[model samples]
Target: MKALSYLNKYLVKYKWYLIWGTVFTAISNLFGIFPAQLVRYALDLVRETLDTYHLYDGSTLQPALYSIFAFSLLLFAGGTLALALLKGFFLFLVRQTLIVMSRHIEYDLKNEIYDHYQTLPLSFYRQHNTGDLMARISEDVSKVRMYVGPSIMYGVNLIVLFILVITYMVSINARLSAYVLLPLPILSVLIYLVNNIIIRKSEEIQASLSKMSTYVQEAFSGIRVLKAFVQEQQSAARFEVESDTYRAKSLSLTKVDSLFFPIVAILVGLSNILVVYIGGQEIIAGRLTPGNITEFILYVNMLTWPVMALGWTTSQTQRAAASQARINEFLNIKTNIVSKKDINRSIQGEIDFRNVRFVYPDSGIVALHNFSMHVKAGETVAILGTTGSGKTTLANLLTRMYDVSSGEIRIDNTPIVDYNLTSLRSQMGYVPQDVFLFSETISNNVRFGRPDLPQARVEQAVRDADLYQNVIDFPEGFDTAVGERGVTLSGGQKQRLSIARAIARDPRILILDDCLSAVDTNTENIILNNLRRIMADRTSVIISHRVSSAKLADYIIMLDEGTIVEEGTQAELMARNGAFRELYEKQLQTEEV
Candidate 1:
């Protein structure tokens, strides 16, 4: 219940809907009670009329009395029919206000969660998986909506109906009313016990749902790997295990839920029996009439739905509370990465890293240890490093994807954190080692950073990356669809397309992170020739292990572990005959072979 209290702000936001809905519920129930009272009045009127007719058995007045009684009964029936129609209209209004407001809240809540997800740091993604995140936003929010819409609606309807029906019953006959309501306390106790089980089971079900979603999502995303390894049967068996767990928990909850209606039905049946038996005894004592017995029976039937719905409303509320608590877990997390200032200053591409030390939070492995470098404006610096030598960490740190652990990085002599986060990233283009492209047309993927870019610019970027000829050969040319993650493209083609995307941004600072590794030497040489011309005035950092890739750089740094081992121009490092020279000789022999 306390977890459900989080929705109070949303209720306040749409308070007018709640107010109008409550008013309509009360009016409908008031009208609903009137038909039972009308039945009572008509029954009593008939009895009195019958007695009067007997007294005037052979008189002229008897004809007039009979006509009057027929007209009176017709009026009673018409009045009851009219009240019923009005009640139906107001009930329509109740749903219109409350249910529609719940939909609006659902829309707002989903957008809020999505926007928060975008703000979370890269580390946050590593800590949590994609499927659980999706479950919280989609499935969990839907459960909360059940409480907002139907539970609230029915709960209010029950409360209002009970007050009106019970007060009228007691006013007519206190002892009979007591007997009719004798099962209520027992119903309350049953609901209390059942709701605890419902909420606990609901939490377990939601957790299992998240696990199942994660497994399916991962399986689909890595279908290629599964096929390559011939693990189809194994994957299917794993999925079945998850599915069975979810199904078992669901069946357990259903078994408990099945008890609700029957319990309500038996209790409601008992109340009806009590009303008839006690009212008939009162009549025999001359304290009540046949009309009274009929009226009490009608009221008991009128109370049937609300009492039955109580169990359903409580079940929905318990599930909602369980779901909301899960939603709150993510919402409450405060992201560590946020812009320190709102400044959006232009960058001159003078980058500097000073005594930087960083350790991965999750793995506790030091990725960079006292690493320092400086790149002058319009200069190209190549970093040569083997795997695990921390080449990619430089790009991540400069982009502020993760902040520095100890020392600082700066662009144009200002701390990277001082610039607006969006502005800083916009001025730089990065091509990652592992290329990724959306499921869109080639042209769209190329110019993803600038959707409004002209066709001429898009074609020029593709041509510069040496992918123009291949793209134009396709049937649809630039309009051809690249399947998820560019699965339609070969490995070299995907890398070239990623390069085209980065170049299309026309960034002042470009980071090419082993992006050309998949391409052949001839294509790599041609793309590098184009880049040398295109990047003549912009600063660039080329990270690679091949000495051929470092030939055009103004300076080269060879790294071992997380620290720089050699720093010089190509000729200078080769002349030293150290680690750089050894690697270059090995690659030269491999190229020849």
Candidate 2:
């Protein structure tokens, strides 16, 4: 209930729906109860006709009396039918108001969750998996919708029926009503005990489901790798384990849920027994009529559904509570990176890393240590590094993907945080080492940064990235769909397409992070030559290991273990007997061999 309290706002938002649904439920129950009374009247009339026949035995008026009795029974039946139709109409209205409201709420809640996911920091994604996040938004939200729709509607119906039915029973005979209700308290206790178990089991099932979904998603994403390694059997076995755990937890919850109907049925049967036994005794003592006993039984029967639904409503509420708690966990997380000031200033790409130090929050790895550098606007500086070196970290910091742990980064002589976050990132074209293209056409992928670009611009950017000839060779050319993560394209083509995407943006600053590693040396040279022309005016940072890529830059810096080991012009670095020169000679030797 405490976790579900988060939905109080939405409840208030759609308060009118709830109010009207409640009204319709009450009206429908009122009409439903009257049919039982009509049955009682019909039975009483039959008994009265019997007495009258005895009084007027052997009279010629017997035929006329029978005609009158027939007419009276028809009136009672018509009244009962009318009341039933009216009850059904209001029940329809109840569903319209309540169930429809739940669908609307479901839409709003999913949007809120997805919007929140967008605002969450990168670290949040590092901590949580996609399947768990998706499960909360999709499966968990569906469970909550059950509570909001059917559970709520049925619960209201139950309350109204119980109040009206019990009131009528008591009005007729308080003692008999008391007897009929005796088993109800025991039923309530049982529901409470069973529901506690249900909530626990439901939570376990949801967790297991998340784990299973994650495993399946990863397996599909890595299907190629799995088959290449001939580990399909092992992967399937692991999936089976997860699936079995999910099945076990679901069965455990169902077993607890299964107790609900039987418990209600048994208690309701007990109430019916008490009503008959006690009401019969009263009739024998001349304190009650057959009609009174029948009416009491009808009232007990009317309460049966509501009593049974008590268990169902409570079960749904508990499940909703568990799910809402998971949702609230993500909603409560505040992103650390946000624009301090909403100022969109023009940046000329003069970047300054003033003693910048950064540690990965998830891994506690110091990716950069007291890194300091300055690049004037329109300058191209190539960053050289080994695999674990801090090359990509520099690009991440410049783009504000993760803020520096200590010290500061400034662009255009102002603190990066001072600029509007969106405007800041919008102006910089960043191509990561790991390329990712959407499952969209190649033309759309290249124009992703600036969607309104004309085809001429897109083609020119492709030419600049040394990918024009390859794209033209394809049957669909620019319109060809790059399947998930550009899996349809070769690794080199994907990298080249990524480069073309960055080039199409015409950004004030461009940071290419080892984007040329997949291409051959000949192709890399052609792309670097094209890049040098495009990057003449715009500030550029090229991160790579190969000396060929670094030679395009006016200045070069080599890093080892997060610290710069060498920095100089290519000619000056070649003159020195340093790490940079050693790497250059080794790479030259490899090419020669």
Candidate 3:
């Protein structure tokens, strides 16, 4: 019961289901116990040789010996059959009510974990592996259900059966009842000791499983790289290590479990032996009748089931406790990114960065240093930078993906954090350098940002991405399924679809981070042509390495080592031989080749 407290909230919600199931369970066990009483009456009737027997109505039932035996046998058979069916009916109710509730609770818990996973800060995902998270949600959730369902059912049934059976046994004969139950308390102590070991070993086993899952998931995700590098054998050898660890920990848990049931069998067997041995002595001394001894034996048989079940239920309980602790590890993490209350400010896309600074927590390196910039509500500002030059970092700050370590970023004169997170993010469109598409239809992917947008808008966005030619080539047109992470599509197609998604949002501000790098100048021109109308009334920040995109911008800024080295209209920067001009010349020379 103490171990079950980890799921206390869920238990409380389904308390009515549990109570009804217990009621049915009580009825089932109560019906099953009456057979022992019938056996007693039969044994005593045999002892009296049909001379002292009476009917259930307290009237004399004297008759010929063979006639009495036949009638008694018939009555016993009919009563037992009726009781069996009644017990079966209640057992069905128990399963439907309690087991079904456990399943529902499992779904609730898993969904709650997944929803929390979505709200967690991106840094939390960086620190945790996919396999570990998967194991917690799938494997751990199942174990918690096991504890509440089978463990609770068997555990409560054992207790309730014991109270009813023992009270009846006492009414028959107190001394014999005490003698038969003497070994039970000691057996309980043995179960406790074994369960302690089981809990410890189960925790270790679950951890090893998580590690193995992580290894398998990551290894397969990089299978293409492994094959390309001809490292198949090396990868297999690494997997062998994880598999071996998992197997070894599972065996250790099994080793502890092996000691439990046999000890319970031996102790319970002793109770039966003591019951028969002492009752036989009393019968021979003429103090107890043959009928009493026979009934006691039947009662002892009933006791064995609950005694054995106690060992199983306790072990199951310990396993659930171990899994619950692992799940809590994820649930207890504080959500790193949280919003303030009553923030309903709408953004109009005038952006400002005033002396902003940020250091990546994982690497402890400053990606941006005192970066300051301003863009009017409807200006096109192209950003130029070498690798590691903080272009993408600036875009991230404007969206408040990560709060700046120092200074402030503002949209329409309000701090980025002052507006509602959902409203602020929905107003801006962002296409990252690394594009990710779900395993969904091309049109569905394009419609992701605004699902309610019309199909005409989806086609328009796809045209703006210069994907019209590619869409017509595929047999499925917009309905084609992109494989996992859009692996079935070419890199350029994926980037175009990402652009289509952002474009369909009709954002107030659009940030494209080197989004047109994979396409040729002809397609880039087509994209630029389509985006001109969209960018005319919205703030656009285009990060590009190509001179074609830069020359079309109203202003371009060159970033070198997290600082602004040059900023002006493209023609002005090209007039002076600056970093931007040098990049422009290099791209022109490369294209001439």
Candidate 4:
């Protein structure tokens, strides 16, 4: 019922076609009953002649026999042709309309889901697997489409056919119809019970399938690691477990299907027996005309399809219901982040955090607490921190990935939340710790941040990021394809491309979050020098563990356990002999040795 409600909007549009299709079905059934009446009438005429051979005129039977034969032949031929045409036309229109509606619904749902995903906090992705989310968007949404297209239409057709058949039967002979329909109520009850089981089992099956999809995606994505570590056998075994679970659930569903069909057959057979036995008795007792009896039997036969269809419809409806529930659940998940409608008028590069605190939605421990920072416009500041010292958390706060649980963050004298998200993000260029590239050409990847920039400008940015020579070395130059996640490129090349993307944006605030770590000292120095010259007027935040990188900044802040323990110039911090000095001394010793 709930699933049907989801499809009501489309159903309303095509209801007229359904009504006419059903009328044609009823007309076909009526014409089908005539042949049986002819048979019974011929049998009666023969019996009459046998009783009075001498008195009966053989000529009198000819016209009646001829009329019966002609009427049956014409009705059967015409009705069959008309039914075929009607069914074809109706089914064609309905299927095409459903396809269109499904496509439109899919478009709307995908856009809505994607838009919601964009607004959701980073914490959501941290807890959820990429494969599972992809499955929901692609596979689960497809299930909803299937339900809307075929399942809803067929289910409604079955119900309408059943009601029409039952109404015709009751009008012909109420008692006989009641006796034949005894099994129908029982069948309905049985279907109800099966539907409950099917829904539960279908949900379990879909869940297992999702897990299988996730496992396959993960294994294939990490195939290189599995082979390098000789974990191929282990990976195969794990995949087999997930696959076997999927097969088991499918088999269980089939078992339920096996039981369903047999029960439906039995109930239909019982209905046939009641119609034949009771209607035959009426003929013997002369209480009913033979033609009438034959018509009743024909009606019973015509009704078998609708009865069978009822059972099949029940199964499809249950599966669709389960799918709808899953789809709706995903659609209903609210995004943790919300953007304001108004844009901040003056968004200078100045950024300030006043005792801001944050914890991941699923975690109890706070990632950042009482973290205060102030940066003036056009200042190149370096943040030095150990692993898990809240450096990334601080960067995320600047972008409002997770809103502060307490205190506030302000940008250009306006609260961060006051600015529209698009406007706020446009003012900043962020390079993440991990550089991700699309499987596209080199030029496309470089120009990703500012797609509308002139080609010459993109070439200049590529040169500034120290990647122009690398790009030219490829046979296809800028047109060379970067494989998935830039797998074709070396680590340093990927990092350099990421830097080029950020530099192309030309944002007011440029943030490089340890983006230079993959490159060697010489390449890093070249890139840093280029960035310093290009981004001299921009407010820059450089996050790194290396003191050499920190030394390039105007001022340095050393973070420890989510707190700023030391803040000074590089020379002053080294003189004080704190965490930065200790890290610098260790690197110097490694270099000397």
lDDT of 1 at 419: 88
Model 2 stretches with alpha carbons more than 4 Å out: none
Misplaced by over 4 Å in model 3 are 1-6, 50-65
What TM-score, computed on C-alpha atoms, does each candidate reach?
0.96, 0.97, 0.93, 0.89
Q: What is the C-alpha local distance difference test score of each model?
A: 0.92, 0.91, 0.84, 0.77
* Clashing residue pairs, backbone N/CA/C < 3 A, model 3: none
Candidate 1 local distance difference test against the native: 0.92
Q: Which lDDT tens digits does candidate 1 get at residues 307-388?
A: 8888988998899899999999888887877778767988889999999998888778899889899999899999999999
Candidate 1: residue 213 lDDT (0-100): 97
Candidate 2, residue 451: the lDDT equals 93
**TM-score of model 2 relative to the true fold?**
0.97
Using lDDT, give the best candidate's number: 1
- Among the numbered candidates, top TM-score falls to 2
Model 3 misses residue 359 by how many Å?
1.9
For model 3, the run of ten residues with the poorest summed lDDT: 54-63
For residue 8, what is the lDDT in candidate 4? Answer: 69
After superposition, candidate 4 runs with Cα above 4 Å error:
2-76, 98-100, 287-294, 344-346
Clashes of each: 0, 0, 0, 0
